[model samples]
Target: MTVISVHVPKTGGSSFLDILRKNYGAKLLVDYGLEATTALAAMTSGEHEIVHGHFVADKYVDVQGARYITWLRDPIQRLFSHYQFWQRNKFPRSPFWRQQYYNNFTFEEFAFSPAVRNEQARYLGGMDIKTFSCIGITEFFVESMELFSKSLGMDIELDNLPQHRVNTLSKKGYELDDKGLRAALYEFHSLDYQLYIQGLEVFKSQYSQVSGCLDTRFWDLQKSSQKSFPPQFSLQKLLAEKQVSNVIGTYYYGDGWPINMWDTFRRDVVDEYLDEVRSDGFNTIILLFPMSLFKLKSSNQKAHEIFYNDLVFLLDKIRDKGLNFMFRLGYSWDGFPLSGDRGRVAFSVLCEGSSKDEFIEEARQLYLIAETYSEFLYGFITWEDLLMFPCNRAPKASEPMRIQLATELGFTGNSGAIPERDSGEFLGYLEFLDIKFTDLFMDLAVAFPRLSAEVRVDTTPYNDSDGGEHHYVHHRQFVETDCDVIGTYFATYMLPEKPTLNDMKRILSFVHRQLQVSDPSKKIFIDQLLLVIDESIGKGYSTISEKVIDAFVKWFPEWLDANSIGYATWAFCDYVWDVIFNGTFRYGPLGWEFGGNTMLVESAETRYVQMESGAWLRGGRILHFEPWPQRGCIQIELEVDDACSITVELSDSYTVELDKRDMSQVSSGKRQVITTEFEIVPEYLKILINGGAAKIYRVGLGKEISSCGGRDLNMNHRVTSRLIRELNNNYGGNC
Candidate 1:
């Protein structure tokens, strides 16, 4: 059998040929620019093993028992490289270059030229993608080689092959100059783009089929070869730490223009806050990139450039701060209208009407953006509340709007007779939406397997202490979607009283069991752990002074280590600060600030408590606490700045500071007043000042409130009663 290599120009064909030659040696039958069909016909008996050349698939159709192989590339990049090559080499002797047509043509003109448009597809002679024994992608050449070598039943030395990044045009700063031309070229080569997309699908399918034949070490080698931006904290170093407590991080929330936020972001404030985060022992930050924002500028070169530059800037800064970054696509909490942009309206309309192809295409564009930045990306979370369907009611639409959305979703029935909420048709519509989202999630996971792509759902039912029914539909969707990570957001506390460290573990254990049964492959995680210091419940309630933060800090790491799931605080900063500082994200009833929840209790002070002697302690601030039932003693932790005499005292009484020289004995470099009995117990404790400045880490209140695993406490009765009444009123059930 003859092995035919169809060498598509500028698609790593030259590099591939070098590998082919190394393997086939004298048995390789080369055409060397001669008519490939003629060369094949002229090949002697020994040369029958391999007949490789740059020829269309048709040229080899009659060659008896020939197996064809080829490599394809991104059409736009390939075209740009082709143009740049001619400009650089003057094609040496090509008739077109000799005529100066290549020299005179602009890239835009060259891109759409009849000679090269859709060149990859043309080279294949419109043959079916499956016609080839093997197809590879130039962009992922190493991975392609592994598959190709396996198919050929040979050991291809991939490491020995030199990298081929030939004739790359002025793409480095193309956006700065002739920005519109890139968009023009993209439009001009839409056929090539579609062909490339099809080629990727083909290549991916082939790779999956032969992947089991690959050596485990060979897969590792491929991973080592993947391009990575230099990280402030290398993934190797971060992964080596193996401390579950380090995983406690928060999604950034505040002050940027959410609509293209990077355009006018406050990097200095973020830098300061991130400095606080690092010092506080957090390791990751999540950024939101809206699909509509990217799609709205699909053809706008300037917008694309701005978005790219801003994203790069933010990512680099995050790296500089030694914080890992994850991103969620589809919606930016910024003021981008849900239906304002054409893409959003298109997706929303399509989703409502169930236009699968259009919605998938929209999702494809979004993932393409992810692919571009996959090097810096750590993971992906689905859009906030995307899985919360039926919960989020679509806006009331005018007759025209309803018709438009209905028409877009491909509704064929009478528009005026659209199914009502309680109707079977409407339920079917919801199910369709669920399935589409699942498909979208699975596609991203497959397309970008390197990144941790997953869905984060509201797992409120699983964490609830009320013994309510779980969101069965939501759970089913997540399980069927098969996301890489199953992230949960306990918007409100699952338990009525503050969940103990043990309670948190129990909650997560139940969740893990559920996910393991559904999809054992998915990594379970807690995306949002609410940090509520003091919450009120109607007429009667309970307050746990500072133990909320304490219990979480103390027990969370153990929970993470035991279950091997990641955890992040609800937010790093207050939600209201965005409205106050940036005046963005100002939607009433939907505003984040309206519900106050964040890790940062006060403006700049992060609630970081050091775990020492089985207690979480915080330093450097005035202390505030409310005795749940009665007054109690305090345990104070202080870090002094300098050698100075001082007095430590509560508002009701005082205690003289210890010798400054004795501070040397304090481990972790902080002085402590462990279980210091307060003579007069006040309703609210206060740390009165004296001489030297001290960082007050913690003022642990004793005898405030106690419970049985956060159930049947002072606040639990009030909350349980209210919740029972609410549930009965809503669903007409007895408690």
Candidate 2:
């Protein structure tokens, strides 16, 4: 069917064009010329689905099966808006009748002009107002579009249609408020007023027939789009049936650090790392594999062979060591040649193209290979890679890729431009990404049976039309996953740099609550429990203190016992490359060295109590502070007993003593923060007790001290090893 959209000026005609274009794509014709009648007469109904332009409705009235649609506004407001728009843009291509007045026209001159008066009626010509298939009201824009779609059967996505206001007037106020001017304008445009009233009546009658239909369909689509895949087996039930204890594990990617471990694979090195992992009291080892490795067309064939052989070798070794393991399928960290591109090309092929089927088939084949080590396999962790788009490029460079992705995800609209972040279309695009991510995890779950999807707990910011910003947390990946377990990483990046013990508790509690609300049936796991993270791998630079590490190690397992199934450290052993470090146990036992006599207490909370006067604990020392220009203040949180003064020393230069006088006077054991600033900050920080006993809880260094708390403190091998050993002894079951 051919549709003629008569675009009356200043009546939302440009916005209507977007809808027409989306519905017709290349089949939509624009006839903005002075003589549209000639073009209308020459065009065939089969050639174009829609002909939209600033033309009269009478032009296509005689065409076979041609229907009409147009938008109308209050004639007084429409004329003033048109005049204001002309004053601003003075569009050179405007109709010849408008060209003479252009920017020189005043509101009174434009409104009283005989040529501009009854302009809407002039566009209608001899055609009856009631003959239009759809007559949209500018005031009721959204509702009009809904009605238009239903009335014309135009295949338009009414819910996701974007508003496209063109040549908008910058004037804040219109002159129609003047009663005298309004009365005179109404009298001058009497013909248009009559036609607008008729069009409105027709619109209301047609809209009433389909009043609640759009809303109902919209809600139905929203409900259907929230697809969930429930796992065949419950993780909690499986753990109990297997008689396995809680998962106490750590991440291992060989000695080459962030690079693919298989590239530097050696039997002796693998054996040594496995031995240390077991000795550290970890019952499980979390291994990482890039999806690109399974892509048949990947250029690194030698790497693929080595990866397969090394994986089998490591799995057999893990079983021999009587340890359980889980595989983390990473989409972002493919390493080496692909690392620069962040595996975007491989991701597009495996997850977004026809090769997705092939990828899944190959994944199934890999699952079959792992079946030989099924006895030692706990599950696979779908690292938060699935939710990511290859967004490493500039927005302009990436827009085409995003558009192609939108098309692949079933967006039928012909909009070539990127949608605004807050637009319904962009949100729909994000929704489609979530659906695709969920579907991919579902496929993996079907193949592996026991799978865990690592969900991102961070919220993304969106700006509203009012220019106010708000955040939206995506829960679809977690809510719709068929994976038996839902996994997430824990790091200070999720909290303030100097978070207190309570702050840590609140953030984790919120994550736990959110996960429960997302899907109450699935069990939760901390796939990467980062006790200490380097600046290279995290959102910001930070250092973790031994006190903080001890506190987390003691509290996290107990908290997990009540809130989740288990957790694994981000890395068990540190891997260094140039200035970058990977794990907490980087300095062996030296990372936990204390400068003075301090008694370590591991009762309810982990802390260091002063054994005698002048006893001090070295919080953390940065040997090369030159690289970190942001380090400025030293902050320490501790409990001071009455009459006991604790001295916080920075690089043995700047010092500040805090006694009970500095306490908030709430309670005797209440934790108080003593922050000391420095002009030339030093690399080392220490806390010393003078004369009496005090409990040191946490210590940190940052650009500035904000409310006194921190994470990413330092810890050595001896400290972490003992902490892990104790956690496993207490939390680990049969494994």
Q: Pick the candidate with the highest TM-score.
A: 2
TM-score of candidate 1 on Cα atoms, chains taken together: 0.42
For each candidate, the alpha-carbon lDDT, in order, equals 0.49, 0.59
| Stretches > 4 Å off in candidate 2 | 1-230, 296-303, 336-340, 349-351, 376-383, 390-429, 459-471, 475-477, 480-484, 533-542, 578-718, 733-735
* lDDT for each residue of candidate 2 in 230-340, tens digit (9 for 90 to 100): 235677777777666687878776654444344334465677788878777787887776655555236546435545666788888888888777777644454322323
Given candidate 2, what's the lDDT at residue 209? 66
Off by over 4 Å in 1: 1-246, 254-264, 296-304, 337-377, 383-391, 395-407, 410-431, 442-449, 453-470, 473-484, 493-507, 536-549, 580-735
| lDDT measured at residue 46 in model 1 versus the true structure, 0 to 100 | 45
What is the Cα-based lDDT of residue 50 in candidate 1?
77
By how many angstroms RMSD does model 2 differ from the true structure? 23.9
lDDT by residue (tens digit), candidate 1, 91-148: 5466766644635888666766777867888888878777788988766667788888
TM-score of 2: 0.49
lDDT of 1: 0.49
